[model samples]
Target chain A: MTKPRQWIERTIEVGLFLSALLSVLVTLGIVGVLLFETVGFFKTVPLLDFLTDTEWTPLFSEKHYGILPLFSGTFLTTSIAMAVALPVGLISAIYLSEYASRRVRTILKPILEILAAIPTVVYGYFALIFVTPLLQKVIPGLSGFNALSPGIVMGIMIVPIVSSLSEDAMHAVPAGLKEGGYALGSTRLQVATQVVLPAAFSGVVSSFILGISRAVGETMIVAIAAGLQPRLTLNPLVPIETVTAYIVQVSMGDTPTGTIEYQTIFAAGMSLFLLTFVLNIVSYLLRKRFREVYD
Target chain B: MTPDKTKALSADPTHAMEKDIAFKVEDLNVYYGEKQALKKIKVDIPTHSVTAIIGPSGCGKSTFLRCLNRMNELLPNFRIEGEIIFDGQNIYDKNVDVIDVRQRIGMVFQKPNPFPKSIYENVAYGLRIQGIKKRDLLDNIVEMSLKKAAIWDEVKDRLAHPALALSGGQQQRLCIARALAVEPEVLLLDEPTSAIDPIATGRIEELLRELVKSYTIVMVTHNMQQAARVSGSTAYFLLGELIEFDETSKIFTNPGDRRTEDYITGRFG
Candidate 1:
């Protein structure tokens, strides 16, 4: 009986080990696939040209592979999204954590989480149909499919992410710290801004980086609302195509699977992946350095 | 009973001698939702002295101490009644700005909770909150406060180092220095030495004698020896009631209440 039990335990251990190995395999496979296509694309378009290109018109009859246009679009939309998300999200978080009663927090937190659960495609339509038209009434030069609308909509979508994560960080600040601030005769505003905010800042920074990462990678909203013109301009009034939108545009069309146009996306994919990976690392590092060290 | 009559009746013998009272509690009742944490707590805490509140765990000692500066109002379900007269004004009055009340009454917790900043920044926090931007003024106050707390000698060289890098005892002292920098009229220390080692406890107890000259100190301590050694007047509590309050000497030598005697002698809690 003991021998059979020991055999079964060994079998379970090996099974558990394999399951753990599966996660590492998934990450390896993604890197492997990206590198395979990226290498092919770089071979046709010189690495320097791809890096330094100011225009991204590869699909045109006269092929030009300037990747800057795509990058600028990605940055522009991400910046707009961040501008919308950061203050709104952080203030909402502060309200929830510092000012809101427990009863209000209980009622409102899930509703905010529900905003996160809304499908990104629905957000895309909301941007295109509702937000763009609304903004056109105010800004005369606004394009039919400008970066501003999608960026703002995407910002709204990411608000819950920023607010919720930041709220967790602020909540993790020890009650003793808050009480200490109060004891010092610091007003509610003083305590919140000076003591509580600074104590939870590393966490807030992590949330911002993660929010930016989420914005950089978001696809459906930009594809639908932000127009398919990868123009290398900072003007929000002009139509723009984010890196994700360009990828979606090519993959949806008749660009042959193994062609240079098709493989350009893998390089773009690499850029997006590298961007988010760096952000996640920074967030992780900041949280570790500050959170564990303080009381 | 009338307020003056009640105050006269509850006045312990030391009250006649100690002319400057820091706080006077009268029928101070505090409730956490429906459950009563303190009931009819009435005592006179003297100014420029250390008044140690001693009680068993969950006996309303900390709650009573918190009520002096209206710190208990931060809790959602916390309901407070009766007056805590600080100096001449009622601290619980609606017109009183809680911010000013807190500025005058500083508290250090059982755990040392220093900001995740440099030791210099930690001591300078209270001053910064008050919008004192002059670097010279800040430096003078920080130096004076740190010197007063007696941690200046140990931390003088490494003032820019993160406060978290300090030893546990050092952190508590840093917290004390931070509280003292605000120049509060009264300092509330809730078991400030409980989390520190004996050597650190000795340093804090030694500092208290000097501190009480400028600031009125209200302390809640579980250690009976600590109460006897550091405090001028000691108030003993049992299940949310003020059982005995008198000169620390009398409480230890000849407790007026039987329960106080039994607890002091380690008969039972």
Candidate 2:
């Protein structure tokens, strides 16, 4: 009986190890594929041109391969998303963490989480059909498929992500510190801003970084709403194509596998991966530093 | 009873005229939801003296202390009846600004809780919240407050260091300095030395004796010796009631109540 139990336990341990190893193997496989395809693409397009070229017209007859226009579009949309999400998400977090009653929080948190649960494709259509038209009424010159609409919609999409994580950070602040602030005659606002916010600063900052990473990696909303124009303009009023949107466009079209146009998606995928990779590392570092300080 | 008559009776008639009272708590009943934490408590905490509230764990001594500065209001389902009169006005009155009340009554907690900022920033925080932006003034007050807390000489050179990096004793003193930067009228300490070493506790007790000269001191402590050593008057609480309130000497030597005697001796808390 003991031998049979031991044999079963050994099998289970090996099975668990293999399950854990599968995820790492898949991640390594992705990195290897991205590297191979990117190197192949770089052989046809020089690294300098890829980095410094102002325009990206690979599918067009012109055949320019500069990654800058796509990068600028990605940066512009992400900026708008950050601008919308940061203050709104942070304020919501502060309200939920510092001001809201337990009952209100219990009711409100699920509703906010539901906002996150909505499909990104629905958000995409909403941006194109609803948000753009609304903005056109106000601004008059707003494009039907512009960066601003998708950018704002993406911001709204990620608000729960930013607010939920940031609220968790603020809530982790010790009650004694808050009571100390109150004992010194600090008003509720003063305590929230002065003491709790600063003590939870690193975690809040990490949450923002993660939110930005989500905005950078988001695909469906930008693909459906932000138009297929790889213009290197900061103007949110004009239609722009982000890196993710460009990949979706190439993948859906007749780009022909093993062609330079086909390989552009992999190259674009590499850039997006690298950008989010750096962001995740920074976020992880900040979170670790925060743990050292408080714990 | 009439308001005047209740006031006259609550304030010890023997010392009512002579004693300078900082707080006159009358029929202050505290409830957390349906459960009562403190029964009808009436006591006149005198000014410029250390008045210690001593009792066993879960005796509502800390709850009574928290009520003086209205800190109990932060808890959910917390309800209070009766009045805590401070500066001749009922602090719990609807017209009274809680912010203003808190500024006058500062509290030090059991564990050292300094903001994870520089020592200088922690001390200046209270003043900064009040919109006191003058740098020179803040510097002077921070120095004075730290000196008063008896940690200036140890930390004078390292004001820019993170407060959490300091020893626990120094951190506690930093909290004290932070509280003092606002120059509150009454200082409430809830087991301030319970988390510190014997040496640190002694230094804090010595600091309290000096502080009472300028600010009214109300303390909640479990250590009977600490109450006898630092406080002028002591209030013994059992369960949720103020069993006895009198001179520290009398309470230690000859308590008015049998329960107080039972507690002060090696009997059950």
Candidate 3:
């Protein structure tokens, strides 16, 4: 009877360990799949042409396999998105953490988080129908489908990401710091700007980097609203194609399996993966290096 | 005779001796939302003297100190009904700027809360806020304030190092230097040495003794011995009520209330 009961307990422990192992396996499998296909893609297409060539036209008869134009478009849209998101998100975070009353914080925090919960596809539709037309009205030169509308819409989508994380960072700052400033005769604005903001800076920077990563990897909004033209232009008013948009475009087309056209999608996927990976590494390093944990 | 009787006898001489009042509180009552934190408190703080408020935790001693400079007004739920006059001006008056009041009546907190900036910046912050742009004046003021706080020798060489990097005692003194840089008429220290080690605490006590020669200082301390050593005048409090106010020597040696006696003797808080 004792041996049977011991066996039962050991079996349960083994089951828990196996489940934890399986979870790790699942993560490694996804990464392995992305890497395997990406490697297969580089084999078919010369690495230099895929990296350095200016044009990305897999659909045309004379297809040029460069990833630069897609990268530039992705870079441009993400820059615009960050430009819109960083200041508004950071200011709102400062207001919530430093100035807002309990009632205002309780009500406004949930409302800001609700923006993050809205689906990306819905943002795509809004960008396509509402934001695009709105931009056209203000700027006569804006194309019917341009990167500006989607980038701005993506900025709105990413705002909560920046605001929430930055708020958490600002909230972690000791209340004593602000009290110290007040004791020194600093006004509310001065304390918020000089003391609180500087203390929470590394966290704010990490949050902004994470927001940029989210903007770079966002697919549906750029696909629907930002037209699928891999033209390398800095102007947000023009139609452009990001790396994520190129993947969606390739996946939707009727290209035969194992063909160069199909393989080109993986190449773009690898670029997207690399960009976000670097950003995540930077976010981690900034948090670890600069964050001050008060006892 | 009881300590209370002796205190009553000794109090008259100090009251008769002093002619100037640094701050006067009249029937001050403070409330946080529905909770009354400070009962009717009326006391006169004498000029160029060290006044210590001694009480158990949460007994409105700190709250009363904050009231002198309207620092309690920063809390959202904090409301008060009373008059606090500093240097012949009603601090709670509608026309009076709280910022200006704070500038004239600087504060040092319980924990050493130096800003994340450099030590030089922390000491220079108060002067900078007043829009003093002359580099020479700022350099002179920083050196003088640090010297006054008794931390100049320790931190003078590392002025550009981050203020947060200082030892706990050094940081607290740095905070004091920051307050002094503003050249306030009064200095309110809310448990300024509570977070430091005993040796560091001794240094702060020594500094406080020196400071009262120039600044009217009101300190709230949990350490009974500390109150005895540093203050010229002492106010005993219990459960939001001011139990007794008298000279520091009399309060420790001869208190006028049973509660004050019990508190000082380590019988009950």
Candidate 4:
């Protein structure tokens, strides 16, 4: 009877272990497929030309396969997105965690989270129709389908991501630290700015980095709102194409499976994956290094 | 020996020291939301004396201590009624500034909560908040405060090290030094040594006894023996009420209330 019970427990433990193993295997399989396709694409298009060429016109008969223009466009949009998102999101987090009462926090936190839950495609249309037209009134150079509109909308979409994570980190700071500051005769603002913000700095940075990763990988908003012209331009007021947007553009159109044009999407996908993967790892490390585990 | 003798002793002018009262609480009642925590407490904390409030867990000792400095005001649902007079003025008055009161009356917590900063920065935080920018002045005050807390010699060499890197006792001493740097007239400690080891506790108790010479000290502790050893006066609280307050020796040896006796003698909490 004891042997049977031990056997039953062992079986259950093995079943749970197998489930965990399966998840890891599935992730590796996806990455393996991406790597295989990316390698095959790189063979057809010389690695240097794929990385260094400034123009990407895969649809035309004379296809020039340079990924630099796409990269520059992606960088421009993401930078604008971060510039808009970081400060607003962080301040909102600070306001929620430090200033708001419990009832207010309960009301506002869910509202902010709902912003994140909105479908990306809805934000896409809003940027294309409402934001672009509004910007066209103020700036003479603003295009009908510009990166600025989509970047601004993407920033709004990612605000909740940064605010929620940052709020959690700020809340995790021990109450004793704040009390210590108060007892030292520091004002509420002083305590929040000097002591609490500094203590939670790494967590805040991690949140910002995570937000940047989300902005970089974001697809639907940039695809619908920003024009699909991978021009190498720094001006956010002009139309630009991001890596995700390029992939979406290529995949939506008709292209044969064996064509080089089709493989370029895989190359862009690989670059996007690598960028976000590096960011995720760095954010994870920052959290580990700076987290204060108060006993 | 008795009340008559004490009165006679008080009559001597040269030996009769007249000290100002640091805190006077009259009919002070505290409530946390719907639950009453402190019930009509009336007491006077003499200036520059080590007074310890001793009781079991949840007996309102810490609550009463927090009320003295208005630290309880931090909680949104915490309510207090009645008067708390500090420095000859009612701290609860409408015109009184709560921030100024807190600045003058510093507090140390149960667990060591040194900011995640350098040792020098931790000691200099209070002064810095007051906008004191003179490097020489901050340096002198840091050294003096650390010396007063009996931690100067150990930490002087590692002034730039993180405060969190210190040992438990050293950290508590650092917190005491941090409080002292602001030159507060009174210091309220809530179980300051409870989270520390025995050696650190002993060091902190010794430091408290030394601190009573210049600053008024009010401490809440669950350890009765510690209260007796470190305090000049003792107050016993139980079930949200003050049971007895008197000389430390008398309270420990012959408490006026049976609840105080039961608690001190380990009969029941």
Better of 1 and 2 by DockQ: 2
lDDT tens digits, residues A70-94, model 1?
A: 9899999999999999999999999
What's the true lDDT of residue B254 in model 1?
Answer: 98
Runs in model 2 lying further than 4 Å from the true structure: A290-292, B1-17
Candidate 3, superposed: residue stretches over 4 Å from native: A1-9, B1-19
lDDT at A166, model 3: 94
TM-score of the second chain, each candidate in turn, equals 0.93, 0.94, 0.93, 0.93
- Model 1, TM vs. native: 0.95
Q: Estimated TM-score per prediction? A: 0.95, 0.96, 0.93, 0.92
Which candidate tops TM-score?
Answer: 2
Candidate 2 lDDT over B146-165, as tens digits, reads 99999999999999998999
| Model 4 lDDT per residue over A1-295, tens place | 6999999999999999999999999999988988888889888888888878888987788888888888888888788788888988988988998999999999999999998999999999999999999999999889988889999899998899889988988888999999999999888889888888888988898989988999989999999999988898898888889999999998998978867888888888988999999999998898888866677
Root-mean-square deviation per candidate: 3.7, 3.4, 5.4, 4.3
Interface RMSD, candidates in the order listed: 1.3, 1.1, 0.9, 0.9
- The lDDT per prediction is 0.91, 0.92, 0.90, 0.90
Candidate 2: tens digits of C-alpha lDDT, residues A252-272: 998888999999999999999
Clashing pairs in 4: none
**Per-residue lDDT for B1-269 in model 4, tens only?**
48967886768786556655688889999999999999999988788889999988998998999888788889989998989989768988889988888889999999899999999999999999999999999999999999999999999899999999999999999999999999999999999989999998988998888889989999999888899898988999988999898889999898888888998999987
Best candidate, DockQ: 2
